[model samples]
Target: MSRPGSPVCTPDWLALREPADHTARACDLADRLADRLGAWPGARDVVVRDLGCGTGSMGRWLAPRLARPQRWVLQDRDADLARRAAAATPVPATAVVGDLADLDTLAGTDVLVCSALLDLLTAPDVERLARLCADAGCAALLTLSVTGAVALDPVDPLDDDVTAAFDAHQRRDGLLGPDAPDVAAAAFARHGYAVHRGPSPWRLGPADAALAEEWLRGRVDAACAQEPALVGSAERFLARRLDALGAGGLHAEVGHADLLALPGTVR
Candidate 1:
């Protein structure tokens, strides 16, 4: 999947949406993870490796809830983003700048985590990640993978059309996109992980006008790109949506899923 908070990813976009992301994430999954780890008979300093960690938002949200003495490895392909992520991390962290294709190098890690990343990966890419995590016997907390379900208040006739086009665009070039969550869950299950899933939908309203506006624009643009014939209707639809947003009559629910996968007891 694509990296949202990494160097190739715009920091401003990530920063602008960070609060909403924090607000929308499945906190219960984190609690469930904490409880699972707590029940481990040999609890010790936990090691967490965040893949594609953009500005350390994952760490910021997960660290406090996890037990103390946690060491984080904030990994990204972008050095600048990695450095920034390290600087903002609340726990001790080592920032690694390298290819995400090399994730298998993180063998023996306790937990593997990522946010807004799985949707960019192809099925095989996710399979490889699952195999690596399974080999390491690590728990995984993967969050914010879009599920292709979005609701817009004051819905327009073209809303479903644009959304469908956008979902198709996301799956372009064989990327799993919104299908990643299900595919990854199955992959983890096949590898002997007990998987749990939770919904983490973004509820955007008038208070989030700026983010909502930008998000709407991107959605419309992607739809247009996916189906060039939709350009005319897309423009009209975007205008209506923006107008409703400005008038405080717009609300949106963007669907995302959080997954927790814990390796089963070793024989």
Candidate 2:
């Protein structure tokens, strides 16, 4: 279920409609993850199960780097997305249409991957998922969870409040209650999975004016709608930032945590 005023789960926002170059920017982040984690012995020859695999973005980013052949299973609740993802993914990829609640269906994967998805699940759901992955002996990589702040310029007095409200909006659904990255990492650690954490922040500037604008629009829309009191203030703030962007440009920080977990403790 989606949270009130949350943009993450919206169909259009979730869709793979970003400009090719913009999409590449996002994909580049995943590529960095592959480089960082692929060195582990367990990562090779592993079957990757991508949960909430929207348009096969993760697959597109990670497939080329594997030394051994990888079997990527792209799973999502949207059948159309699954179909499209299957079509778009490189060879050696499969698509499954289902929800995360069906842990039984997730069996047989060596590695579990979910990008920008943990923040959408409840605590129980996360716990259940960690246990399931542990049972399957699957290493997991979960990424791109929002940290709830975007610094386009110098900080303002209301920045903290805006970010707090947005975080509340993300957790209001009760299912995914807050910084899911942190929660999921802890759950995995408890289940005996040694997890390494990394940060992937989208640092936008004049070079990324277009992508920055798109992200800003989505973020402002969600923030204002979630807290009506911030509507006017958000607009004013966005206007000033956009103007600044015309010259000095603005930087919106899209903070995410990259988690790498294995079956055994790191030696």
Candidate 3:
């Protein structure tokens, strides 16, 4: 089940990063997931249920890559996003308006997928997700979980400070934050899935200034929000950042991780 987050997702923002997201994702993991699903005894007809299908980005990225006839089920907490995602997805899609909870009803999906979603859940929530997937004997391809590492070219004096604060903000509400990928892998492994992980970092360069600037603003804003004391220098740091970005001299490598889990091991 995909849960909503504070400010991690929005249609416009999701659309803006789609290209980078696809590029940053580890293609090997997707290919591996496709192979596992291909051999799945239950996949006479493949069903990919994207939990929290915001902007439908996950489906658009994954469906064609799979070598099986599939039906996309895009579920979202926002009804409009659900319907819009269903309509815009390249493949035929069905939209369901809701979150995936109530484990009793988690069956019927051949494969589970979600992008940038695991971090929004708690450890118990993640364990439950793994358990549910294992019980249903479904494979999962969970992608783009933040890894709490941001490297910026021409680093600033306060870059580490801002990143630390931003990460703290991510963990403020007991959320997994950058710890999601590891936690998810362990959870899946504990529940009898053979889990695989690979780095999916966004390597942004001069051409990605727009996205980089937007990412910088959000990262700084979240940092300042978590620790208001960073404001004075943060404002100054932000200015220099914008100036560098405007001059096309800025680059950043934002960290993320992707996970692929195929059932059947220690159950």
Best by TM-score: 1
Better of 1 and 2 by lDDT: 1
TM-score leaderboard ranking: 1, 3, 2
Candidate 2 has its poorest 10 consecutive residues by lDDT at: 16-25
Kindly report which residue stretches of model 1 are placed more than 4 angstroms away from their true locations once superposed.
Answer: 1-6, 41-43
Q: Candidate 1, residue 229: CA error in Å? A: 1.0
Clashing pairs counted in every model: 3, 4, 0
lDDT agreement with native, every candidate: 0.89, 0.69, 0.85
Give the alpha carbon lDDT tens digit for every residue of 1-267 in model 2: 343222235445554233322332334444544554566566445578888887777677666655556788888877777777778877577777776765584467867888778887889888989999888777787766655545646566666767766666777758463478778889999999877776666676777786677676666776776798998888887787677677764666667666777777321
Model 3 worst lDDT window (10 residues): 1-10
lDDT per residue for candidate 1 within 1-267, as digits (tens), equals 346434756799889889988998899989988887777666467889999898889999999998646889998888888889998999899998865586655575888999999998899999999998888889999999999999999889998899899999999999998999999999999999999999989999999999999999999998999999999988999999999999999999999999999889731
User: Comparing 1 and 3 by TM-score, which wins?
Assistant: 1
Error of 2 at 137 (Å): 0.8
Report RMSD (Å) for each prediction in the order shown: 2.1, 4.4, 2.7
| Candidate 2 backbone collisions, by pair | 121-175, 121-176, 122-175, 245-249
